[model samples]
Target chain A: MAVVKEEEFEFHTGQNRPAGVPDAIQFIDVHKTFGSNQVLRGLSMGLPEGKVSMILGPSGTGKSVCIKHIVGLMYPDSGDVVVAGHSIPSLSDDDLFELRKKFGVLFQDGALFGSLNLYDNVAFPLRQHTEKGEDEIAEIVNRRLSEVGLGNANEKMPNELSGGMRKRAGFARSLVLDPEIVLFDEPDSGLDPVRTALLCELIKEVHAENGGTYVVITHDIMSARRVAEYIAVLWRGRIVEAGPSQELFESENEFVRQFLAGESSGPLGME
Target chain B: MNELFALPREWLAATGEIGRFMGTVMGDVWGGRVLHFFGESLRQAGILIVSSTLVIWALMFILGLICGTEGAYFLEANGAPAYAGVFAAWCDLREIIPYAFGYMMAAKVGTGIVAELGAMRISDEIDALEVMGIDSMTFLCATRLLAAWIVLPFLYLAGMGGAFLASYIAVVQQVGFVSSGGYLLIFWEFQNPPDFLFSLIKAMVMATAIVLVGCYYGYNAGGGPVGVGTATAKSMVLNLVLVHLIGMLGTQVFWGNNPNAPIGG
Candidate 1:
């Protein structure tokens, strides 16, 4: 394990103000590494239940790795990750799979099964986990697709869709199961500004209607402004400040202010 | 000095890793966990039948022709033209067909699996399946192995028929060294039902090893498209070596003591 230099983390206040709600996911001193490059270093944070929380970070700052940890796709090297009262790394494979039923994750490019059309991709989870007939599955699949604005593109393959459409389809697939938690890894990536705002709006509308613990991992300050009810600004694997979205936007910490405001001048710079 | 052994050490490590991965997938099938996705297995079986069966049969037929032509000329030169059937029968059934099947399988199905699953892994489709609470190993790898098991035997049998027909045409029709009836007599005289079974076993074993090796490489593929290409190349090289090894071992074990000759009798 490579030692994290102390001075490099001077602005890492780790100030996690309460979101005034119970946590849906918690990372306790989570340290993850790849070979010699440590991504998450002594990181601890909490995402409150039934709110859209944004994990805001610059590029390559462990934002995506954090989402993997929450879903048990990757485990921490030293610390623990608890999702809805279940320790991620300690659970058996079967148990971990069962626990994953509570999660719906949207990968960056809408990882829809290439073999299936849009409709079947959305219907996949319901068919796997439920005894519902094709009629019922179709109803739920169509409904979710409609919610994501992909209702008319049911028969199209993933490659036929544009980047934003793929993300929307992925979002639709993620919601079909009515899971208790949803994790979106850079939902705004690869989209134009208008589409990003539209996706942010779609996220807000869906959260209002369905109400789950939605964690969006992104660096887009506009997305944070539009979709985040709670915010955690991560840098160098540690949180600089986290709180209600307004509080994080108004934070006094230099790193937090720079990241949230997207300013050029601050403690954060090209390393 | 340490660098001297590094490449071999890496190969050993990779072999062990692939062995472990194959064991887990085989365990999933043996434990009936794969039944959870039986439909997927059936789908894969259908894919194998539709996509690969004819190509395999065509290759086998072509090799059978080569085997028969070579055997006929050799026996004709030796003044035993009437016994050309002996060479054709053994060559087609014992070695040529199985090796051809293995070569085609390694080239087609093994590399196909690596490319498909490698793409899935890179594009996060496998991760998506895992997060959806599916046991991806059972769903993806074990189902593929089971599919190969279910479909390859019948396909191999049919391909053997094609090879036999091609060999008969080459020796009796084209070479004209023996009449059809005489060729049939010598052919039946050289091989028994047990020999047929041994040939089937040899071919099936090669198919199994190819499928398992493909799954191991495909399921664990990383890096990206280039990585997948590398894995596919590695699987092909390994499968070719395994095909010849299994071919040699099968012949030694099945026909070493008694060559099943009717000459002395």
Candidate 2:
């Protein structure tokens, strides 16, 4: 178990990590519109090479949409989303597929293959991306499975696993490619608090162990406080407040105060 | 008062939904074309190769048995020459089975592929696969198209054998004058080698068209499970229609715009 610093996990309300740390991912002036409904309006952020940068926002603020562009699933209407250096839209399909090797994303639900058991499910990306023989694949798969604390549940189907274990399995999949930049699209969603707590612990521990860049999209204030070095509150597609988590947590921004204080009377609507 | 206009609106909505699903279908086809440019679809070709051996042997034995019996039966009953009866049976073999079997294979395998992919689409698995960097088209469509092209000729050979065997068996064993050896003599004498080749060539061309159409519809099927059922129906019907058009066009090329090719006289 590697050490995760207490200061590194402080609460912030906007995107600003350790400066001069060198960005592994840089999004500059990115605009994405789906048939005239503008999802991202000039969005920009940088993920420092070996730290966790959490993207906190309300629903429909284009969290999944943002990650899709990173993987080249959808192209930005304008501006740049450069990953490991190359801009996304300029890359061809084969180039995009090759570039995706650096990414590991845990989708909201653990999207394991229904036909495949847990062992095979975790082994899928390795088989697709690498030409490793079965013995090597088995070794890698078991090591990842144990990392998420599911070493003994190798033969179970996804349906048989609990919500917590499924998410853990999804996390296990993210590490299969040995990705340098891990992107989590709300890892805490729909999980019980106990599970969420364990997951938050795993996220920090994995970061410390691997020393890779992390981008998490979450609004769970507790998990945000637990794991994020810096946090950005994406309200209506603008970073209302962003800085070091500790500084922002102690700051005077109305939205930040209202948000961190967990008040119901703020501008955030039920709609 | 304007509620009556809902009927027309519903119809237009249906049209638009179909239009969008069709756009998705065209997208699959375009992707398939790019991959297929390097060579023929290996899936279709494999199907042609495997079905060729089986259909050939099965149809040949059937042709021999049927022609022998049928020729004898006609010779004894109608007093027509046994050779005439065998030629008539040959006419059926050279034409019917080749076209019908092509259509059947298209119906069975073509509809099955459409349904399979359609279900995957309905279940949201397709979207999931895309996010994972797996190009679903290259994996699914390439295999199907390759199998069809590779296996079509084999089916036609079997069709030929089946038609001849059935005719031979009915002619001799049921009626009696055409001996077993006589049936073989009649088949070789009356059968033109080009006719057999022509049947296979037609099946080969039709198989490619059928498989492509099947994959195109299946990959983009709408309305989930119901959409899959609809797409399968559409692919089968479309395959049948395309086969007719290709069959006619193939006949024209061989027969020079005549209904029948200028051979077997």
Candidate 3:
């Protein structure tokens, strides 16, 4: 619980525009606090369209909170979050729901309904939102399950699956709607290194085929290195630096260098 | 001093939150989205029956036996054993069965709902529904509430039957203190439609309160597994208090002026 001074945290406080691409999601001076503990303070970043951007941060740095704001789950206390050009916190209930239709979120624990089997879990959005016939739903669900390599595990309950399998099933469910923006919150939190690398590969391969804006929030440097085209390093409720993944990796900022290099000693002391 | 003020403030805030939750549930019900979750509601009803019905029936049956045996002893001692039938009918049909059913429902179904929804809340499934553009309230709480509404009246009826049978066995068969024909005659003489209706209404009202309290605590559960357990406990405690309060209020409103008995006057 190191409380860094607000002035010592250096980062841009507006949308970090890419060279020529429009951002699919933008946060402008977003500030959020729970009780007296502020989690996100004047944080700003842009996730470019049709690119895999990772918001890399240590634990308790509001990475997951950022994802929640993008999906309109949590509104900012005082700033703006725009997803796909729709300003969140300003949308009415109906409009917010309509906005959320464009998003697919894969929670860390999969978040599949415990009562529903894997097939029904994947088919849930389609069944709720569309008048598609059962045969069509089965076809779409089966295809998505197969895409995540869980085609055979359709009848199994969520608790029956291993951690990796559950994450895959969740990934399948997230893509079932063909969402324009997919958010992954700590997709590699509990998996072993081998499973993590495999998941990263699957993400890359899926992004290559789907070509949607993908924002993955993770503290895993290996995942950030392997999957990120753009990277934003958040520290102490602010972005320390952000840019193209290669540029961020080769930056001169002491905090960014220490974090990316996994060094223990730097401006970020152990708190 | 701060603690005293905070307690009432928290209670008022919780009441407001429950009111808002009920409003959302009613809106979803009116919007026809509740029908979309009807199958899920029926599934939950089946689970509730399997989990809570037998225990409730058994509890009521035991209570019936105790009441019947005790009333027969007192009536026989006073040379008015025939009036034992009226006692059994009144207590079982009007007061005991409904109150016991409310208690059982709070202990079993209410706690179960809290635990299930609390676990779902902690696991982020509710937020997952929001991200998928589904109304989690309608899909989760409304479905469970509807299931309780549809199932509890019939369950109460079955429990009443169990109570009457237990009373008959205790007074006529097991105790042999009264003739079966005599007991049945007086029981039928005293019982009427309003007794059944009011009891069902009481059970249904208690069921609604239990479901609402359970959903409120569970859906808003924070922290983690320990938080979920605490929510379950809190729901049960609130439900217990509400069940008794509703039972007393219902008894006053439904049967205060009109006892609706054949021989009471």
**Interface C-alpha RMSD per candidate, 1 decimal:** 0.4, 2.5, 0.7
lDDT of 1 by residue, B1-265 (tens): 8999999999999889988998999999999999999999999999999999989999999999998899899999999998888898889988899999999999999989988898999999999999999999899999999999999989999999899899899998999989999999998898889988999999999998999898878888899899988989999999999999999989888877664543223
Judging by lDDT, tell me the better candidate of 1 and 3: 1
Best by DockQ: 1
Per-residue lDDT tens digits for candidate 3, residues B1-265, read: 9988998999898789888987787677667778977888898889988888889999999989877887788888999898789889888987888888888888888888888899999999999999998778888888888888788888888888889999998899877778999999988888788778988998898888888888888888989999999999888888989998998888788777774632323
* Prediction RMSDs, each to the true structure: 1.7, 8.4, 2.7
Q: For candidate 1, give the lDDT.
A: 0.92
Candidate 3, A1-271: lDDT as tens digits: 3243757565434224363588888889788888878899877777888889999988898999999999988999887998887899999987988778888999998999998999999999998888999999999999999988898998999999999999999999999889999999999999999999999999999999998999999999999999999999897777777778988889887788888989998777767
Candidate 2's docking class is acceptable
Superposition error at A136 for model 1 (Å): 0.3
Q: Is candidate 1 or candidate 2 better by TM-score?
A: 1
Report the lDDT of model 1 for residue B138: 92
Give the winner by TM-score. 1
Best by lDDT: 1
Return the TM-score for each candidate structure: 0.98, 0.73, 0.94
User: Looking at candidate 2, what is the lDDT of residue B48?
Assistant: 47
Please give, for residues B1-265, the per-residue lDDT of candidate 2 as tens digits. Answer: 5799999998798657655654553465555543532232453455445544554445455544544554455566777654645554554554455456556667666776787678767754455466556666665666566455445555556566666656655665555566667756765665567766766777777776776777778888989587799889888887888888887777666544333335422
Clash count for candidate 2 is 53
